[model samples]
Target: MQIADRIEQALDRAVALAQGPGAPPLLASALRYAVFPAGHRIRPQLCLAVAGACGDADPESADAAAAAIELLHCASLVHDDLPCFDDSALRRGKASVHAEYGAPLAVLTGDALIVHAFATLRPVAARDPSRMATLLGIVTEAVGSPGGIVAGQAWECEVAVPLADYQRAKTGALFVAATRAGAAAAGVDAEPWRMLGDKLGEAYQVADDLRDVLCDSDELGKPIGQDAVRLRPNAAAQLGVGGAKARLEDLVRAAVESIPDCPGAADLRMLIKAQTALFFPKQLAREAA
Candidate 1:
């Protein structure tokens, strides 16, 4: 099966298991709204790729991990769009969960997706309990703890926060988890592939920052300039648009260079590098003569 089809099926199964038995009607709807027609299952796809490149090509084995990371990503979006955070009205070209479902359900939706992520891992539970446990732990830490995405958001509220630290948690945490967990699912050490994940995430954030400036609402599927309007410290805000673009290129090259000598690592790295080319040229075209 195509990787996209496989990832979608895995997502379906994961959400199904999460909705088992006593799901609240509103929460179920909220969860569904948050996940379906997902803008880009980017993190999950990267997870599957990293695992396969790291040497576990079964795809099915990596499915649970992919779904797990994507679920958490969905959960994060549900909360991030609340009035308290980005106050976003649209995401992936539709009303955001909170905008459509109400704040209470939005909270429940995020929480449900988080719990569902763990539940989805049951299929791989027996294959590698230690790795599963490690993955679960990593996911939890990446979500909302002192150094997690939640904290990353909270840090923005503080008087001062180190840009690098915020960047790692807010954007890089889930990505790092995606790559590391993929390695764990394949029963391999995650260290060698961690840098690759960081590079992809850094490039993602830089492009995201650029999109916040260069891309239009219709193109981005959401409001543009939310970062500047909200005073969110982004690469562009911190480093001018030109600097941010350069930073993105730097990250893309580093990510590709970080790949280890495994037979599949180079291709995996190139796949990630391709993403930079995808976003950069589009942004350039928008400003061209």
Candidate 2:
């Protein structure tokens, strides 16, 4: 099966399990709403890609890891769009979880997804306890406090924060987890893949910064100029449009170069380049040109 299909199947199965008998009806619906019609699915795709590049000895484990990453990502989005954060009403061209399901349900949905992410890995543990432990540690560190996505979000509340630190925590953490967990899922050394994830994650955040500034709500399916409105640190605002675009290009190149030698390295490089090309907004491309 294709990578995309695999991801969808895993996610669908997860959501189905969550919706089993005795489940709360509205909360279940909210969970589906938060996850379905995925936005990019970049993190999960990267996880599976790195797993494939590493030979994917355990395809089932890789699928679980990918689905877990995506679930956490979806959870983050649900929380990020709440009134306390970006207050975004639209996501992926549809009403956001909080907007469609109300704040209480949205909060529950995000929390449930977070728990479900860990639960998704349970079967892996039964099969290979050691591999499951490694994957759990990777995923946990990416979303937990001190250096994870949670820290990234907490930084927004602090009096002062470094841009790079914030970006790495808020965005890069999961990407790092994705790449590292991918290798672990395949029973390979995961450390070597961290650089690729770091570069790609930062690049993705920079691209997001550019999109927030240059793209309309209709184009991005989310609020625009939020960085300026919220005074959040933004690469585009820190670096000029041209400079941010240049930075993104540099990161993409670095990410591709960072791919370790493996059977699928060449193909992975091509895929990375192709995927990142879509990151540039048409207007940004025109301006850069």
Candidate 3:
């Protein structure tokens, strides 16, 4: 609740700024529509969880990083659902930004949210220049080239999209940033925690793959089976349903094992386990059984 509250407040403030008297009403509303009511908030929660495990040297800065990661995530979803991309009409049980506010505004709204993501970090940068710089790089790289979300999205356009690369960039990059930035915010070396985030992120993507195949729109709070509809690369398609479930289980185990030695290692491990249960829902397990 604390983490969610912080995110809500920050998003509200950002949207409020964009809702100035001269601001377009629907655009401002669309921004709020895309962010609010929140999803699982898993990335930001992981960020806060990692910071807590790492000692939380600066709570305020840690909060900022979590907020920034979420903003970037929301921005990605908005852009991802545009007509040019996934063409998803629903998000979090509501109309997608593009569906609700038209495509052009959706594009600008996504762009504005990306800018807000960085702006959200400025206060942290002012408080600790080093941490700020590190976080800036972490977030930028997570959403940018080589192995970022952008690259991940681009893989869909490729004639031959590598499964590992696409999954990592499209989903894992932000998760990596979450854990690494959390550790960085807490004045620790973020490298040891990198694999934990990667494994978790991979697990997340696999779970999503299963969900898209096994679930329905009402259950998922969004459109399901989009990968097949769009002909995009998906684990369930590449590996088959059983194989994807096995892969998801393997990633979950690896994620739990990858937690490095830290002051709160035990708690972090437990956190990973609890989160894993959510990823591998009881229905999934039962259906497989």
Candidate 4:
């Protein structure tokens, strides 16, 4: 199956599993709304791609990992668009979960998706306990505690912070999980893939920063100028558009070079190149002109 189809299937299965006889109808609908029509699917694609590059011995486990990562990502988005956070009405060009279903249901939906993410790994654990344990550790670390994405969100509520720390925690943590867990899912040492995820995550955030400034809500499928409105730390704000573009290019280069020597290295490099085009389409257009 195509990677996109695999991701959607895994996600669909997860939501199906979440729906029990006693589960509320509204919550189930909200969960579906939050996760469907995915935007980019970058984290899951990164997970699947890294797994393939590492010679995935068990495609099932990798699929679960990819789906779980994406579930967590969707959970983040649902919460991120809440009134307490970005207050975004549109997501993926549709009303955000909260906007469509109200704040209480959105919260429940995000919470349910997060629970379902860990649940998605249970079958994998029965098959390969060690690999499943490692995946869990990697994912929990990315989503929880002192330096995870949750901490990334917490940073926004703080008084003062370094931009790098904030950016890495908010955006890079899950990416680190995606690449590292991909390797771990393949029963390999995950350490080597960390840098690639880190650099790629940073590049993606920079690109998002640029898009927030340069693109309209229609182009982004969400609110524009959010960083400025929210006073969020943004690369474009700190370094200006040209400098942020330069930073994004440098980070993508670093990400590609950081790929370890494997038989699939060429394919992995091409994958990164393709994703870089997604990250900096405007820059590519400018250069072509």
Which candidate ranks first by lDDT, i.e. highest? Answer: 2
The 10-residue segment with the lowest total lDDT in model 2? 280-289
Q: Give the Å error, residue 80, model 3.
A: 1.2
* Candidate 3 segments whose C-alpha is farther than 4 A from its true place: 18-22, 287-289
Off-target runs (Cα >4 Å) in candidate 2 are: 287-289
Q: Residue 184 deviation, candidate 3, in Å?
A: 0.8
Q: Each prediction's Cα lDDT score? A: 0.80, 0.93, 0.87, 0.89
lDDT of 2 by residue, 1-289 (tens): 9999999999999988888899999998999999998678999999999999999999999999999999999999999899998888988999999999899999999999999999999999889999999999999999989889989989989878789999999999999999999999999999999999999999999999999988898998887899898888999999999899999999999999999998899999999999999889889777656
Model 1, 56-102: lDDT tens digits are 84455588888888988888888888998888999999999999989
Order candidates by TM-score, high to low: 2, 4, 3, 1
Q: Looking at model 3, report the run of 10 residues with the lowest lDDT sum.
A: 6-15
| Model 3 agreement with the true structure over 1-289: per-residue lDDT tens digits | 4767866676677667767688777777877887888799999889989998999888888888888888889989998999898889988898999998899999999988888888888888668898899999999999889999889888988988778999999999999999999999999998898999999999999999889988889988889889888787789888988889889989999998999888988999998898888887456778756
Every model: Cα RMSD to truth: 2.0, 1.0, 1.7, 1.2
Q: Which residues of candidate 4, in runs, are more than 4 Å off?
A: 281-284
TM-score winner between 2 and 3, please give it.
2
User: Alpha carbon lDDT of residue 8, candidate 2?
Assistant: 97
